[model samples]
Target: MNRQAQAAVMFLLGAALLHAGATDLYLRYVKAGLQPLLLASGAVLIAAALATAWYERKRTRAAKAASASASASGTGAGHTHPEPRISWLLLLPLLSLILIAPPALGSYSALRAGTALQKPYALGTLPAGDPVPLSVVDYASRAAYGQGRSLHGRSVRVTGFLALDRTGTPYLVRMALNCCAADAQPVKIALAGKLPPVLQPDAWLEVTGTYSPKATHDPVNGGPIPYLSVTSAKPVPTPHDPYDETWNN
Candidate 1:
């Protein structure tokens, strides 16, 4: 790749980053908190690319003038500096971003990480609301450590991707991000009952269910994972924000 090609790559990358930041796509990979930073970085990168292009153009013009003067003075411009070639490998990531910006992490990642019981929260009482809408993290915490005692008689709606293990055990998994996808952690909620056979792993679903008191709680270290008794499972499109932001802190 010549200087122009290298500059073009930089410009494309910067534009891609900016596009990701400006759209809902960035939320798929990272928290909304980083949007401003991403936008700033993209803008800076584009500006830097523009500046570099300008500098290179100016330098090339100067080199031509110098070479012309030297040639006129009866001396050949000592071999012009060779243009550098950028490796083609640099295009892979940019192509990936352009062609297929991957969706948020799914069952493959969730299964690899497995699921852990949530730590106990000291909230004296569960938050007020009927059919209390809660994050998988919150539901897991209350179910595991609180022994479903707090969630008793409460109808709740939990949304996440459906993941099934080799044993055919189904789980609703949601990833929580602290800063970015790099620090993402999976929170899994086991779902009971026969789900639609057509539903493949990583299929997003909104499960309205109640916590089973039968779920064994390991208070020692919150070891035993919890389960939910699914009342109704409905297919839903991927959420605008796929991650559970409750645990982002």
Candidate 2:
């Protein structure tokens, strides 16, 4: 492609990066912490593209003037370059980002995962709330490794999408991201009591339950899978940032 097209592509790509960083669209692909880096990268790309375009235009004008003077003197002008056209393909991802943004990963990954997220470093005493709220990752950590000492008496509330095992046993599940979706691990707590009728697959829900000492082995990795005795449950809208960053935390 010509220099002009290269500049245009760079500008579009930088704009896309800036847009993603400036808004929640980026949360679908990366953590909140990377926003600053994205914005910086976008600015650099846009500046470089603009500078390239300006220089190319000035050089083109100078070349034209030189060629005109050469023709007036009856001398030949310099030859132009003929670069490959494959560079035009660089526009595909930019167009995809603009027109058809990809959706975040959901239950399809969680249910088939080889294992859940690793246990947190340390779990403190359950906080003071009638139904104490916790991330699914935190609850799983408390339930499995810490022996539910903090969870025994207090009712707990957590939110995540619904998934079922091969035997149709329901679970409250969330995808735990260490970095991005590519490295996401499932954080699941089995639901052992009555739930909302016809719980749709991958539907987000808020569940209030009591932690049960009884546990099951992970079907894939043979680790402890904690149980939550469902006392109350409700369907909820999907969260803006669907990942549980507690793993990163």
Per-residue lDDT tens digits of candidate 2, residues 141-165? 8888888888888898899999877
Clashing pairs for predicted structure model 2, backbone only: none
Candidate 1 clashing pairs? none
lDDT at 179, model 2:
74
The reply for model 2, stretches above 4 Å from the true place, is none
Model 2, TM vs. native: 0.94
Worst 10 residues of 2 by lDDT: 114-123
What lDDT does model 1 reach?
0.80
Model 1 lDDT per residue over 127-185, tens place: 78878888888888888777788889898998999887777878888988878888787
At residue 31, candidate 2 shows an lDDT of 74
